[model samples]
Target chain A: MTDFKNLDISTAKECLLKKEFSSLELTEFFIDRIKKSNLNCFITNTFENAIEMAKESDKKISRNREIRDLEGIPIGMKDLFCTKGVRTTAGSKILENFVPFYESTVSNNLISDGAVILGKTNMDEFAMGSANTTSFFGNVINPLKSSEENTKDLVPGGSSGGSASSVAANLCMAATGSDTGGSIRQPASFCGLVGLKPTYGRCSRFGMIAFASSLDQAGPITKTVKDAALMLQSMSSYDEKDSTSSRKPIPQYLDFLNFDIRGKKIGLPTEYKVEGLNSDIVKVWDDTINLFKKNGAEIVNISLPHTSFALPTYYIIAPAEASANLARYDGVKYGFRENSDDLEDMYELTRAKGFGDEVKRRLMIGTYVLSAGYYDAYYLKALKVRQLISDDFKSAFEKCDVILTPTTPNVAFPIGEKQNDPIEMYLNDVLTVPASLAGLPAISVTAGKNSNNLPIGMQVIGRPFDEISILAAGKLIEEYRSFL
Target chain B: MSIDNKTVRKVSKLAKIRINEQEEKKLIEELNNILGWVDELKKVDTEKIEPMLSVFNESMVMRRDEVFSETSDELVLKNAPESKSGFFVVPKVVE
Candidate 1:
């Protein structure tokens, strides 16, 4: 029996190329693992389809055809991406049974690259919450239980919680995740995985269910930075279907993972060392700075003065966009519909029943902000502030090649700890949101483990479309810590 | 900038999401809590700054007006909650 858990994507590809194990055997290994695991990582398992695809991949390999980057790799996709003929829930009842006739550009790109689809992973409803607790399918339990607090169930952080958990638990080689305000990075931090949210528009958003369209960008949650690079290469493509899709050339990111950080300017934002930051995470940040320094990288103290406004700006802008994007889900074309006597009643009832509390709260906040009287006061002001926030990063990037910070304020907390308090929950995205706001590529890599043996992650923020730099920096840390 | 139950109800109506008396009470507290926190944005001096419409700072990529691929009507209606004769079935909008 192959010890698939010990292998990363690169080594697995090498094994596949050398005929150590067939794609069918590898797919069955993961399918069996998924059946045995209790992570609740997947909302839907496309086992039969995956097996069929893996069989086809074996035939192509035997025929001596050119293999694609992700060929024969069994991977989980966040439920946000619409999979043709498979349920794409976005972890909401509104799309609970919604099977798309079309595939998302990202998923289609993955499929075209010869990747075998494992299933749809669970996430926050419409990718709203910071904790995965808001998912309609139920909360994904973090496999990393605190050694000290063994009684409590640790949460695999939000929105991309399932993606992070599955990759961490070895259920699949890697999985896709959509990050809007730290969904990818925070969960990656909590679950001890590599999560990369590529520059906005680096990956097309053709059929991914819109959360906050402007902020939402799909990337990968993988066990290693190199796997993230490979998954992202397969996931990104320019499509006319999404207007925001970048026409820029996608680089062979794995080629840039040499970890030679000589003379690389790494900026440490002083504002990130705020009062409430856990001291352990601060120590990890300090240790990371030293690690980079030992690698001959210059660590300069920088200030993004507008950092305080990021969460507020994100809350206002994200919900405003979400209200607009989600307006189409009035039980008209797909998903759940509530019975009512009148059109207006049906629309209201269906939405009320379909959406959960966090989603509803955001929609209400969105509607209120975009409403006539409050438009200029709330939405417009928030957008202008967003400009300042983005400008701060632009100015900071001019001075430094990359910015480093703790991925989250603290390590993974127990599942139900912060779900009730919205503001407490929103605080999880504070460090991760600035990059999303600027449409810059940011990656979270495991830095160290905390006192309780829970994983902690450090984020590397790069310039717009400069994913290679951040990936290289991430690779340095990934190697320095020997995380892989 | 404080949100009240009345404001929550009005916004919920505008959003076309039904909030009951209990939910409205809860929403009022939650919305107020969030809005209170969001009020910090008002402190920032954003004078003369243009509202960012998008991060790309690029014009929408438009294609020439031509039919590219023919999507079957059945494919479009595949996920509909209710449909009949290649049309979505919904509560009467007009009369």
Candidate 2:
């Protein structure tokens, strides 16, 4: 039996190249684990498709043909991305049986690069909630159990909960994730994985089920920073299908991993140190600063004063866009339909029955903000605050190469703990939302473990399109902390 | 910023989503709570700030005016809940 737990993407690629293990064997190993796993990480599994793809990869290797970057690597796709002929639920009951006829650009890119599709991992319905509990498929249980109380179950932080959980548990070598506010980073923080939300427009959103169009970005949630870079390289490309896709040349991100950050200016935003941050997390942050300082990096204090408004602004903008985007899921089109006597009744019934509580709540909030009477008071005002938040990062980046902060206020909380209170749940993304609002590239890497043995993650925020700098900085943290 | 049941009903109607009496009451409370928190945005001074429509300042990309490949009707209606000969079947909106 292969030790799948210890294998990372880079090492797995080398072993496959050396003929030590065929891609089919690797695929079957992961597929068997997925079938027996108790964690509800996947919403839909494509084991048959995975086996076929792996077989093809083995044939290519046998023929001595050049292999692609992600060739034969088993990876999880967040259920949000539309996979042609496979069920793409987006963790919503509305899309429970929705099978896309076409593939999302990111998934298509992965397939073209020879990556095998392991399965579609679960997520917050329509990527709305901070915790994965809102998923119609059921909440993804964090594999990191509490050391203090074994009976207490931890939630894999969400809305990218399943992606982070799968990577943390070694269910897959890596997985893809989407971040609107803090979907990728927060979950990565909770699960002790490296999750990167690249600069907006870096990856095409052509077939990603829309959440907040402007804020939504596809990124990688992986076991290591190097794997993230490798996956991201294949996932990113300019697409005409998505109008917002950037035409900027995608850099070979793996090449940037070797560069030293001896004199890199690291910023510490004081505003991020909110009132209720756990003291243990603070200790971890301080320890990370010392590690960077030892590496000859300069730490500078900075202020993103408008940070307080990011959460409020995100709530307004994300839902507003969601309200418009999700309007397409009426009974006449794809997805769940509730039969009714009238057209209007059918529309109402289908949406009501199809959406979950969080999705409905967001839809209503979005509708209210964009309504005739409150547009200026709520939605328009949010757009202005959005500008201020983006400008704050713009100025801060002038003095720093990368900004360092704790990814979440604390480690993973027990499932159902914060599910009822939306306000309490929104606070989980307080440190992460600013970067999303600014459309900057940011990554969350495991810093250390807390007293309960739950992993703590620190975020490294970089300038737009400057993912290399943050990746380099993240690698430093990973290396230094592994030795500790 | 207080949301009442009437407002919830009105918003649900606008959103084309049905809510029962119980759900409406719950929604009213949840909406009010969320709106009250979001009302803090009104406190920020934005006298001269332009509303940011997108993070990227780039204009909409223009493609050459040309016909793309046509999608088959079967593929187009593959996921539709109700479909007829090359068209979706919906409740009659026309009188």
How does each model score on lDDT? 0.91, 0.92
Label model 1 with its docking quality class: high
lDDT of 2 by residue, A327-433 (tens): 99898778999998799999999999999999999999999999999999999999999999999999998999999999999899998898677889999999999
Instruction: Name model 1 segments beyond 4 Å from true.
Output: A482-484, B93-95
Instruction: Residues A141-179, candidate 1: write the lDDT tens digits.
Output: 998898984469899998999999998998999999999
Predicted structure 1: lDDT: 0.91
Position A329, candidate 1: lDDT: 95
Question: Could you tell me the lDDT of residue A324 within candidate 1?
Answer: 95
TM-score, second chain, candidate 1: 0.88
Each prediction's RMSD to truth: 1.4, 1.0
Q: What is the DockQ of each candidate?
A: 0.83, 0.85
Residue pairs with clashing backbones, model 1 = none
Please provide the root mean square deviation of candidate 2 (C-alpha atoms, Å): 1.0
